[model samples]
Target: MTAMGKVRGYNAGAMLLHWAIALAIILQIAGGFAMMHTQIIPDALRFTTFQWHKTIGLLVLALTLARIAWRLLNPPPAHAPMSRVESGLAHLVHFLFYLLMLAVPLAGWLVVSVSPTAIPTLLAMSPDLPWPHLPLPAAWKGEGVSDLAGTMHAVLAYSTLGLLVLHVAGAIKHSAIDREPSFSRMMPLGRLPRQSTAFLAVPLAAGLAVAFFGGGLAAGRLGPESTSLAVNAAPGESAPAATGASAWTIDKTASSIRYEVAFSGNPIGGTLGRWDAAIAFDPAKPTEGSAKVTVDAASIDVEDAFVKSNVPGPDGFDVAAHPTVTLSVDRFEAAANGFVGHGTMNVKDKIVPLYLPFIFTESDGRAHVTASVVLDRLVLGLGLQNDSTAQWLGKDVTVKLDLFATRAGAASPQS
Candidate 1:
């Protein structure tokens, strides 16, 4: 067949692939922006959105590759008559669109691969269906590499948007203004009425406006907020004095430290199976009390054996490297219900200021103290960054302690 006859229009397979990939890309863009921009999304919803976005991105990458292979094997239809420069510009735009479709998803994949948070990309939450791991250079296994890849992903995605606008505008112009057959070439059912094309353009423009402006507004309103609290002294600095306090011995059998956080939209509780504390306090003189506590990071137990074992690994606690977490409080201020202590916490090689509020009751030389505090996991370098992974695993961790103590050289407190 002659070139014009052979290339009269895209084959059935080409047209099917075109619409399939186009629809997937549109959904991916919408989901990506919505998930990234919206603040305070319920954890489960946010996780589901991210999973869909990642899955769709992978699908787009696969479909684009297949489309390219098909296009190369079977040449596209001959272009409608136009100026040489116009044709060249159209070809250049088409080429860039394809290039960006490939680049954008690969960049996104790289961002997920090197993320310090280390969330796995599982297909439909099935461990057996995870995306193939992409090997990283030794230097690329850090936040810096992830940040660079994230930037590239954003840039390429915007570039793809720009090219899409141009491509769509050219098609609309050819169909509605110039009254040409250009737009019909790839249409499975051939040319539509000019009125139908105009109707389609109206909704297309509205969708674009919503995606751009609505997304920007959501991001501005819902993005992460500053949660920094004031600290009296920097980490490792001298703490206030707590003298004139009687030393107390902690009753190991009755003392416990527990933490609670939201996981998969449910409240999950855990405990530090092994920990110790040294306390010196006098209920009569609250300001003269001090306490030091140490936690064995490897002993974190969340009820699930698999999760329990993994929590101590590099991506979670890195307990092998930083085996212990410690907190020392030497200053206390009386509160309406209890006393508040100012201190510093050392974990994962990062020291951060900590505040503890507790209620203390004493009877017959024995004391029972109940304390609680909320810590921003990120500040302590607890392997949770401000990325999607961190969002899935909530930011604030609530630590609660119950201690039974007695004056030094005294017997254990009677129940």
Candidate 2:
């Protein structure tokens, strides 16, 4: 090799992109591992971490592409003198690193795309990245595709971990042990000391250890059996009678149904503003009483206009296609607290059995009722069907109802 072949330092743009991508990769590695332990982290925080990880992965992919183009347009600084074997090994590692840089995130993207959950990838909690909703082949549908992609992603991540260690060790050895300017070639802000490069390995090693072991621990703790809720009823059950005893009328202004879910590590709740209920009940004749409710799915107001508008979108309530959600309860039995009702709720043309526990009280010829129920949103086709999305958004949703009613011939409470 000629004396002039020795590289002095990397260009400004190259250095910046290198360090930025490195930092992002480290964060992504750590976050990805931590996110797997949803049982350990708070729900809202876990979901937020996932969004951030996804966003960073995409950014890394873009940066890697740009770096590749830049390298082609402007070749990297020449290497310091080395034996032919050393040179060949270095080039091989570099090539492998680049391949992994591209493949890891691409695998992750595929995992998300083929996911049955159909969860949207949002950037910074606002603008959503456009992801293709491609149909999987019959052989690759259901859990098969997601599992394969996920395995690929995990394997690629560990490969990156190994590559990262070798790359860092090589850089440190070249600069510190060999007393060469090899590491300096990629630094824009002049050459760092050999000791500093050696020290860098400490944190890198610590990070890799955390990511590998933490991910393994999380995976073990949160196995397939640990994450899923017990599904008691199948979808699409027949509707039951609403009332069996005395007929009653719901006071629209005095009744409301609300729902709560976790988003970004916070509890976000909203009311179904447009709904109607029919009640027929008598404390003396509990078996003869029944109740029914109809809700305008589009009328969900989460307080945030943006979220409210999207709640009825294709991935959400799909209000345009299925405008109404209905619930019917034909069986009512006395309970320790108050009363229990076995019912069925139909949303988006999908029906699931519902169990309602409620408290009822009457005074001044008017009855006041407060009831609550928990339902699996996926079973009712209210959201995406993938396991990851279910973990992020929570599978079970709690619905609470408050109502005041009067018998057909009874005087109104206000009157």
Candidate 3:
């Protein structure tokens, strides 16, 4: 095309980007509403739905930037002959669509960046392609910043709905009401007049788009791989050491330690992934020696992602500063159904009295044990700082232990 040539309709690149971004925005709006109102959706699908929402949102951001860059290099066809007021409204709505299309995703990213959960963003829901959070400090992840960003994200998203309606109405007026070839301008099968695209506009506009969004993502890579959320855990190879040897050797594969609490009237539970126990009690004697159970505070694995993140948070376990929670029992008393173990448990630097009522059944050389204990979160310094009233998080946490063990040695060596 010569310099004197005038563009008709949009170039191939511009049209492709325009439709791609439009489709993404529609998915994003629908997904946004679904994710926010998760109570209506099944529990198992909520996490996948959120990941898809983020994936599509970032897709919209990328395509929007590409569309802006393409529009710069290849200007659209001149507006169909229309009144001044009509053209002004079209330009205004188009400009806003571009603005919100970029701003909405950025705000959503902001919400994630400052979220106390510090949940990572994985592109295309692929764990391998992790998108870094903005290099914002972990200390800035307060409720205030998170709430503000969340509010902005939702507000901008709904605002785009208004702009979308206006844009489509304008296009329909020209195509149906005025009988102009407006929709064909962006249609893939439609033919357009020869258009001159400025190769010169490519470098400058594309450079800005890359520098702004790409550079930000690059800076994210330079920062922490992920937000800290105040969680610090020793490597998996490291575990707490037991104090005294026990008569029974634990079968780690068949043993589990679980904790449960109520969240918003729903039961939420998690397991202590790493733990060790030293027991000297004999099932035949019912109560004889001491027992110690040490838990890796960092090994908390909550079923809910949101609740999982908070477990290591300052208001929860504060795993960063307190790495382990230990419970030790020196005496056990025979009971009607089982036995009662009197102990003291330490959590978040707070030592509190702990009691576990357990049933023990032994046949041959193998023993089976089941224990359950209910503890007040406030007494153990758990969630006291975050929710003293237990409005959302329950005040009581119930811990249950089920384990299979084998008697390690003979009862007495008199051979």
Candidate 4:
């Protein structure tokens, strides 16, 4: 074989970093896509994998920058003459590869930066870059910045994947057909025999380790806050009745009903706002009360763009046709905990029954009610793949409600 190109061989440090970053990027891709396809994977593990992906990605960028600086300091030998087409393709491919190397992570960074919700920094977990949770003037949460960033991230990810596949094909073509050490010379370690064990063992172990640690960090460190949510109400002066006749008169000023949804491993969750509801209750007979609420199907919001897009959007509700989601009380029974209520939720064009276990308290003539309910998104035809059930649209959507009631004489609370 011709003497190895003087510029060809990568040093040990550069080679190690390259392999490590490549392995990490590959595993992250697999893990990420796998998580998207399979809901069975614990969310904590998914998060952990993402954290590691970010961490390693930052490391890759740092090393690549250093390599660029080093290349500038010590120039390499010139390439041999080649055909015009070969030269053009070589240059184009190399340029595209470099762009992917930088673009994928930067795109991801932008997506995270514009995230509408705050990402908690856990103890012992240091961020490689500045957290972008804080809102800038006139451009805060609910703005379209994150959506744009997210689209860019997805675009770059696919671009990178295409480039990666081409890179592998080019390497194999050069190594075998050209009978040159074009690919081998750059190997930090010397070329391996066909079907070498090192090729199998090293990459696999490293990927598993990274995935495990990444998943663990996300699950352990970045988990949701463990605190009960409470909404304070304006005080009242009169005494509450004890004849099991207390009824809740919801605030009329409230144009929206707000609550946050949290799951064991999900960093992203549902946020509901501006539910259109009408309360019908007998002021004198508090025990007899009912509520008719219609939530805008398009009003659902999520912190993560990926999760938001994955969630069935307006099509799930067809808010254009039926802009409102209605809920009507079916049954209410007093229990030691508070009140157990059953209601029929009308979403999209379908109605499903939901049960809510809640606590109702009457203080100084005012009634406060708080409850939680879990319902299937499938009944609403959410996450349907050709009308078949899929777990990607989790079967259960947990809803939390905290409504403050007042006498009819008071103005409705601004929702």
Clashes of 2: 11
Screening candidate 1 with a backbone cut-off below 3 angstroms (N, C-alpha, C), the clashing residue pairs are none
Model 2 error, position 222 (Å): 35
lDDT of 1 by residue, 1-415 (tens): 1123233566665677779888888777767777777765665787767766877787677667767666665657675566687788899998997898889888998897787655556545443344533566757867898899988988888777788898898878766765666667778775332211223433343454345334433442333210111111212222232233488877778888889876656567888777767776766676887878877776666642213324666656777677777888878878899888888898877888888889988888888899889888767666454343564565678998988888777787553
Worst 10 residues of 3 by lDDT: 235-244
CA lDDT of each prediction against the hidden true structure: 0.68, 0.67, 0.74, 0.53
TM-score of each: 0.56, 0.65, 0.72, 0.47
Q: Rank the candidates by TM-score, best first.
A: 3, 2, 1, 4
Q: How much lDDT does candidate 4 score?
A: 0.53
Q: What is the per-residue lDDT of model 4 for residues 1-415, given as tens digits with 9 covering 90 to 100?
A: 4433432554443456557667766765666567557776675565555555565655555444544444344333333344587667767876786677677767665665555433332222343222222224436434388788767867776777787877777667666765555566447556432211223434444454455455545443333210111111212122222122333455635423443333335534666544544554443442466666656555655554333432333334544556566777746666677766667877777888866677766565566667777776667675453223432234666677777676555443443
Q: For model 1, what is the alpha-carbon lDDT of residue 307?
A: 30
List candidate 1 segments past 4 Å from native.
1-7, 38-44, 191-260, 264-310, 322-381, 384-392, 395-415
Which portions of model 2 show Cα errors greater than 4 Å? 1-6, 33-44, 125-141, 191-254, 261-274, 281-289, 296-325, 330-368, 374-396, 404-415
**lDDT, residue 369, candidate 3:** 93
Query: What TM-score quantifies how close candidate 3 is to the native fold?
Result: 0.72
- Give the winner by lDDT: 3
Look at candidate 3 and tell me the lDDT of residue 279.
Answer: 79
lDDT of candidate 2 at residue 51, scale 0 to 100: 64
Q: Which ranking of candidates, highest lDDT first?
A: 3, 1, 2, 4
Q: How accurate is candidate 2 locally (lDDT)?
A: 0.67
Q: Which 10 residues in a row give candidate 1 its minimum summed lDDT?
A: 225-234
Q: Which has the greatest TM-score? A: 3
